[model samples]
Target: MNPFELLGVGRDADEREIRRAYTAKLRHTRPDDDPEGFQRLHEAYQRLLQIRRHQANQQPPVTMAAPVAPPAEPRPASTPTSVIRAEPVFVPQRLDIDAFCSEAFGRAATGDNRMLSEWLQEQPAFWSFRAKADIGQQLVRRLYRDEPAMPTKCLHVLLNFFDLDHVHAGHDALALQRLSRRSQLAWELMPEHRQALAARMNMQRRPLERCLARLQRPYTWWRALAAGFTPNSAKVMPQFIRELAGPFIEDLPPSVSQEQIRFWTSVGHKNPVSGSQLLFMAGVLSMLSLVVMLGAAATTVFSSQTDMPRLALLGIGVAWACGLLWVALRYYFVLDEWLSRDEDEPARWPRLRLATVPLLLVIGLIPCLLLPLSRGMGFTFLLPALWLSLRRYWRRHDHEGFYVSPGIARIGLLIAIVALPISPSWVFAVATLLAWGDDLRRHRKVLQLAG
Candidate 1:
């Protein structure tokens, strides 16, 4: 082959083209990396260039006489030549779990229930779901030819329609939707047989459901409040109550039953407040409220009436009182009721009561704070009280699974940090507390080290 053609570049190709082609070919046939291949290409180029150069010089042509033919021995019988054609190279397809998951999610998003049901029915028996138990088993037998891990989530969703109190159905519907997206990706990660095994694993979902049910059945007051109507029976679902009460029996209050203990554990698992710490928080807040109120009344009655200093003092006093009241209601009232009572109604009131106090107090205090104070002591008290109330409220509501987002907290923090120092108006601080505090609290709960 011509050297230029071998390199796959034009004859009149510039040095750059030659270099580029050489680099491209070098990656595949590394004569330095592969000595024999490198030598062959190098030799071909040298021979072609040398011949071209010789032809360009154009010396007189020299001719040599043809050699006489040698006498041949008896000719061997001609052998047939066999021709073999090269097959095209195969390039294996790459599959990723995430990509497969995305594809599955896309299929689900089309909202074709028959197609969705058909696809799920094709899975291993244990992992399958049906509209009803009898039909589900028949489908499983038809699909898997044997029992397998059942898709508990699918069962829960279906069972909820039949009036079974499947607690997970309501909250986990969205979670299940997301998890199913990951199934496609998981499918891509395994071979056909392993995929079948995964289906089998899913088929055995009863144990997992039982375990989850055991963990999940207890009723927190928040959950009950969300469920609507007070709980008539202190009896938590049997499976859940047994597991949660065992570990903390000694730590539980005298009034608490095995059922109440189960419920309290459920509450603690769901919320930030728990153990003796919540009581401490309540005590602190109650004490702080009394101290702040005394200071506010003393200052307002005795101190000289000036706008800024008096206003700042009043702002601080009011904010402190709000925080104190919140801590008291949350710990001493709401949480206590939830801990003691069979249901959540009493506990929920305290949370609302506390949440309102700061907003109302802040509204009244803001105008006063904007006025000039005789001394900056008002701002000092106001700052801490504002910080504490904001922080408390923030922590109360915000959590990993809660509605608050991190971006919201960061924006509010930036605004508060910027405005609270320079702006005489309490708006910045209040906005920050309202917007970011809950988000911050939620984040802290997720990231916090256990005390």
Candidate 2:
């Protein structure tokens, strides 16, 4: 339900009304008693507060001029009208490289390079080559090598002399290699410049071959991913993979499409529901069911004189399994619905691949593997699973908002671990209940600002 409808308040309701409504609702819907109800109420109250704050901050709209009045004077048809003409303004045409460079050289010749340096200082293009000594050196020697000290502008102007279209000779390649030697430009930018020059010269450019001169330079994977693997990027995957390898000789796999790469990258950021909250609730439910089943089994085992009904025990086991399956399926559908809300083709497989396989291995497979051996063995197995789960949760906290803190999850694990040796059935049950209780309260606070 919408926040306003859930709160039983109008859109214009004040903070006081919202708070009052929330308090009244909380009386009947405590987190421990009715988590879903309390969650809805808390979300409504928070949404209203945000709406109120937004309304208060908004500026009142200013009305513009009303309907314009008709002109008072009607011009006579007989009167001759005079038209005013605007004067033409002169604008200078752009100077070509040859003309600009010639003027700079003339100024330098007249004043021993001082005039040329001052003019070059005002040119923005000169500073772009500040770090390239080879490119700067060509301009330095040609322009002001005889001078005692060279100005920064002279170096800049010299860089502007090279025309990429004219870089056919071996000297051009040598100059570029020398310029790249101690250059401080970003790896991507240097390659980009080289590519542009190659394109202008009508030469085939191989970024992988040209860009990897040094093996010691650090490579940023994420930056490369962002640059080469974005959805709209025109980069070829095979070429990008080659570039990523730098100078390494390992055989690389063929690159996937940009859409596939984007889908995989986006999976990490998807959080339709708070993972910790879901985990807590599921853990609690599982623990309680296990405790009840274990208690019945324990009683049956202790009473050796009386024969237990095998059929009845089998039926109970089936019913418990069905219940767990139902819960799991329901949660899965809910998650699917939430994630499908915005995407056209949600590409569920990629997300499932990223989130489900590891989860199953840690939470389901490991525990199930130990279940056939002993109840104590199963409980012991859970310690490592829970620890791994906690580690996964901690790592994802930055990307996904946490409903329960990693510390709390760790504490819950500790409690279960301690309680297991004493009472295996009670360990999970108590921990699960506590986890849900903690999650419910935390979730309420989290939803307060949502609208």
Candidate 3:
């Protein structure tokens, strides 16, 4: 769009005239009602200003031959003899704040840091510490109101011009303290800003960053291993970054000095990547399963059966093991609607879905196929008793709305699946009685020791 036509102004109009045209359009085009129109007007306003600046720069300097000496009248010489003195007029320094924002934060670059610094110091409020606080507060409010306006340069300018990052306690002015207090706030900080802060401080990174890194580790680790290097490189980082960073940003628990947040927020975020531990663990386990398959294949060599059957079983074993790994991977990233709820009330699977039935069937089938009938039956029934002994190991974990691990969850699933093909009611009855018996025994032992 031609900005001149968009603003309904002639190309020769001054900055104030173009501003007036935009102001008129701004009133009629409410952002909520006509966002596109408002955006167009905003773009045109910025473009027109850039064009004006370019024109001013390119225009040749006007030079004229020296004016004739007759330009000075003889009366002026007579009047000068009276020793007329001209008083210095006080021209009030009015800060056109709207103009400042338009020039400073417009889409196009205004100038280098030096030019911006000069322009910023030109404001009257910059000289008065208290007024600097007042005017800066107004500019901040305006920026927040128009949040679509990114703070790439404006944030930097504000920190430098107002000294928002630090305060000198010995200073006589109290306004600097106010600016420092405002600087410590997190309401104006965005996610990218906080992540960058965490990176530079050598602090724990965001948990989401960790999750992503864990997910991507396989390709990276595989590449490294193929190149004859260590697949596992350890870094001592917090298990969860958000836990520590939350307090820092909010100034809760007084986690860090105010200067840290200020300097970090001032840095422009260009680095963009993070960690993912869960998927990396899954890949490690998958490789372990492959190693076990290799061991099983070696043991099959003694069998009298033809090599064809042994090879078929080996292939089936590999596929089945891989299926388990696939299930783990699937549950990790792509969960069903039931498991997608918030942590306060986590999602759960339905009763009949048969959670750990695959693991149970796989374990039970090995004994039944290889052992004598009597021993196999006894061992199959003994499964519930062995499971009941894990009472002390039933640890509680954070159900972070996604798969962190599958240990205890698979156990609970195994028990639920027992209700189907196994001893429908006796397994639960036996497990409950065994757990109660262990507790009773412990209680009696403790009492005996005390006595």
**For each candidate, what is the lDDT?**
0.43, 0.45, 0.46
Candidate 2 overall lDDT versus native? 0.45
Candidate 1 local lDDT, 189-260, one digit each (tens): 223333343354453434434333333345354443332121212233333334423443443222234444
Looking at model 2, which ten-residue stretch has the lowest summed lDDT? Answer: 247-256
In Å, residue 396's CA in model 1 sits off its true spot by: 4.6
Residue 244 CA error for candidate 1 (Å)? 31
Task: Give per-residue lDDT, candidate 3, residue 9.
Answer: 99
Ranking by lDDT: 3, 2, 1
For each candidate in turn, the TM-score is 0.19, 0.19, 0.31
Error of model 2, residue 439, in angstroms: 4.5
Q: Output the worst ten-in-a-row residue range by lDDT, candidate 3.
A: 266-275
Q: Give the TM-score of candidate 3.
A: 0.31
Where model 2 places Cα greater than 4 Å from the true spot, the runs are 1-381, 388-422, 432-436, 448-451
Candidate 1: stretches off by over 4 Å: 1-345, 348-357, 360-364, 367-406, 424-428, 435-451
